[model samples]
Target: MTLRVMVAYATKYGSTAEIAELVAATLRDEGIEAAAAPASRVADVRPYDAVILGSALYMGRWRRDARHFARRHRRALRERAVWVFSSGPLDPSASERDIEPVPSARRAMCRIHAREHVTFGGRLEAGAKGRMAKMILEEDRGGDFRDFDAITKWATATAGEIIALRAEL
Candidate 1:
């Protein structure tokens, strides 16, 4: 059976969306059938064997749709396998430490039990940012800073895990 994977994401200014697209492509390249869609439109999780949900964090919070997506699908996701990633710290100068998980996200994680959760430094486009976003951009130390290589490698590893699980089934 072809593994159905979803790269569901909530993006503010499209950077995270690009990341989600990259992830979906990476999974497809590994022979997993993957789809990319905004989390808000993901009404059903039953069609997918595995899910990779990503969110863009701004002002230390995920977009509302991301939270709602997890809450709505927590039960269904726990029955299968899921993974979560946060794209933020748009400022690479910021410490590359694991963020203190939020209450809602933590509660949902405890219940849904996603296989893995990771945070990666994000990208910033100076032209598109607003006041606060611009402030955040100003603080960036430099470079593309999106870490595409790491993101692609992690995505491949995620697909590998899903492939192994499918084999066992």
Candidate 2:
């Protein structure tokens, strides 16, 4: 049977949602069944063999929806292969090096027994909905720093790992 994966994410201005969609698409391309959804809308994790949970970071904290999802489904998530990601670095530092998870993400990962956590570059654009975002744009710091190539690479590797686990099972 094909393994089913959920790419659930929380985003303030939709960049992280797009990343989640790409992840699901990449997994599907790798022959796995995957779908992306908002973390808040996912009422259950029982239907998925694995889950990749992601959130947009602001001020080094995860979105409230993502935090609630992790807490609300912690038990179910522990029973599945769980991975976590954060997107927030407006700079290329995420692509240049491995960035550590924020304290909240670290806590959630430990609580849910997540298999891995990754940090990815973030995007900020004009018309984004936040005072900080507006200020960033005004200061010319707003741009799409997300590296799709890196995202695809990570998703491909995640698919390989999931497939290998299935084989062993």
Candidate 3:
């Protein structure tokens, strides 16, 4: 059977959503059947064999909808192979090493016993900020910090894991 994966994301300014799309594409290229969708719009996890959830980090927290997505699907997620990712640290000079999923995300991951958790560098667009993002935008240098190669690498590895697991069954 083919591995069916869902790459669901919560984005602010659409950066993380792009990352989720890249991940899904990479997985598909690796021969896994994958789909990317906004976390708020992904009403069910039952159709997927595995899940990769991602969110934009802001104020040291994940977007509320992402958190709710995890909580609402906790049981189903726990039963499947789950991966998590956080996208942030828009300052071009900031080390991606310093970026990681925040506490709330960690808590959710723990509940699902996530297979992996990655923090990817994010992007900042010229005028994508909302009214509330103004303060955070002040600290942002406004650049594309996402590492596409790294994202692809991770997704490829995830696909390998999924394939291996499918073989074991």
State which candidate has the highest TM-score. 2
The TM-scores of all predictions, comma-separated, are 0.88, 0.98, 0.91
Ranking by lDDT: 2, 3, 1
Residue-level lDDT of model 3, residues 115-143, one tens digit each, is 88888887876776576466556766567
TM-score preference between candidates 1 and 2, better one: 2
What alpha-carbon RMSD in Å does predicted model 3 have with respect to the real structure? 1.9
Q: For residues 48-82, what per-residue lDDT tens digits would candidate 2 score against the true structure?
A: 99999999999889998999999999999999999
The whole-model C-alpha lDDT of candidate 2 against the native structure comes to 0.95
**Global lDDT of each candidate:** 0.81, 0.95, 0.86
Against the true structure, whose lDDT is highest?
Answer: 2
Better of 1 and 3 by lDDT: 3
Residues 131-161 of candidate 1 have per-residue lDDT tens digits of 8867755776323457787789889999899
The residue-level lDDT of candidate 1 at 107 comes to: 59
Model 1 pairs whose backbones collide: none
Residue 157 displacement in candidate 2 (angstroms): 0.2
Off by over 4 Å in 3: 92-98, 136-140
